[model samples]
Target: MPELFHKVLKAFSSMKAGVLLLALLALFSALGSTLLPDSFNHLILFNILIIILFFNLSICTFNRCRRIKRLWGAGTGIIGGLRQWSLIILHIGVILILIGGMINNWFGESATLRLAEGEQALIAQDKSGVGVNIQLEGFEIELYENSMPSQYLSHVSLYKNSKLEQQSTISVNHPLRYEGIKIYQQSYGNLVEVETEGQGQVDSSTVLEGQILEIADSKWQVKVFKYVPDFDLAYGMESKSLQPNNPRVIYSLYQDKVMAGIGAAPLGEKIEIASGYYVEFKGIKPYTVLKVKEDPGLPYAGAGGILFMLGVVLAELKIFSKPGQGNGNRKAVVE
Candidate 1:
């Protein structure tokens, strides 16, 4: 029984075993990404590979450490001891990185936040039902002389439990980090403001592109199907450019859910709906889209990264670059 146990240990600690496990991991990862169904146990298989790789790394590190400690005790010199210990640190760093990545894969989550200017939304809720919210204070877009968008930004204020927190600006590639969550400025678009006034009733509302605007207690509703920034009649309702040079909206008006009229008009153009009811397109308003990601294992992976860099620095500096130093990949490691 003892011999069998030793053989099993030896197999796991072998370099061949490690390489085989890594190959299998890569193979299944590719298969899972391209072909495997999510309902399959590919996740379970991936976790099992992770566990075995962890064990393999642990055993190899233990064996290497034990051999290095023996040499240090027998006076193999300070340089030899330092080199071996550096390798040991590298091995430990790899183990920590693997564990942290697994934890992150299992626990992390992502969601999106969409807010028009002066709009508020709930970003996410924790296990205890405590929610985090953000309000879009303002949005801006910058364009080059050629009429192409150069940059866009969103000024936002965070809130927790109805209490205000600090405000921040988010732009492309610049994310706002608050309360262990990251909010990235993902995209921006225009919202159509619709206003109707008739029979002494004025109702106002906003609608995103390709959405409908309906009036309460009224038979008139309109679906703004498209928005063209640089409207050109010569292009058959297509925009000449993305500069909002001649902003126009194409819409289909409906009465009692039946199509009444279809037309295209510039922003703020009033379209007659009925004898005493009319709807006008207000100015375009910018809305911000944000991507929110929460990953709990970031700290763990960060610590592991520091340790790994420290190990590499130690190996590179070679505090005592004698003939017997540099790495610990000698026959002793195999033995």
Candidate 2:
């Protein structure tokens, strides 16, 4: 068992093993990007690979540091000692980066919130399990001379349960953070409001495409299956542009998980789900998609990055030379 353990440790500390681990990580990344529903960070195999890489790095660093200490003790000069120490520091920095990324990927909370102006939606719960919500109070787009959007901003209010907690205006660069949760305005789109009137009950909601909207206390549920900003019926119902020149929606209605009806219509048109049960595309409005995240490892990763740069600079320093090498006359060899 001890011999096997030594063999395992030796393999982990080898450069070839590290290279193979990196290749496997890249393969997992490609698979996740092309086929998986979630990210590579969310995969068990990816995490296992990360753990393996971490151990490999740790062992390599340990062995390298031991060799560096021996070099230092052998009186390799101050410059040589610092150069060797800097290499060790670089190794440590990489290890810290891996650990930090693992912590964030495993424990962080990331969610996207799509909210229209004057609409509130649940952002996410905090570390303490407090439900947080964000309301888009107002939104504006600044246009340039060519009628292009220069910038967009969102005035938002954050609430915990029923109490207002914070209010701020967030944009592409400026993000609002509360209790480690950051909200950034990632994108903007148009929302289609659907109205339902049936059996003496009237309900309405503005929903994004693929969002299920409930009506009449769960008696019926409807979702906009697709929305074309510039619907062109002649081109196989494809959108001509993303400009909303002729907005159209394809919707599906369900009752008890069974499809009751499906219809396609232009904005403000109505379709019957059942006898006297009507659903209509009321109107379109602007909405914002906010990227909400809680990353506890961000600081560690940042610190590790700084340390890595510092190590690079330190390793590049060649301030001193051997006593017999002459003053600035001898060339320094880099290994």
Top candidate on lDDT is 1
lDDT tens digits, residue span 1-335, model 1: 99999998899888789889889988887778777643222278888887898899899889888888788777776656666677678778878877886776688767787898788888877688988789999998877887778888899998888888779999999999987889998998778888877776888987888888776568878888888888887987777877778888888988889998898877877777787777888978878889988778788778878878887776555555666544453433345
Model 2: per-residue Cα lDDT over 197-295, one tens digit each: 877688877777788877664577787787877777676556665566887887878898788887668887777777767788888788888888888
Clashing pairs in 2: none
Stretches of candidate 2 exceeding 4 Å from the true structure: 1-4, 124-131, 161-163, 195-207, 210-280, 319-335
| lDDT of every predicted structure (CA atoms) | 0.80, 0.79
The superposed Cα distance between candidate 1 and the true structure at residue 197, in angstroms, equals 13
Candidate 1's C-alpha lDDT? 0.80
Q: What is the TM-score (0 to 1) of candidate 1? A: 0.73
Clashing pairs in 1: none
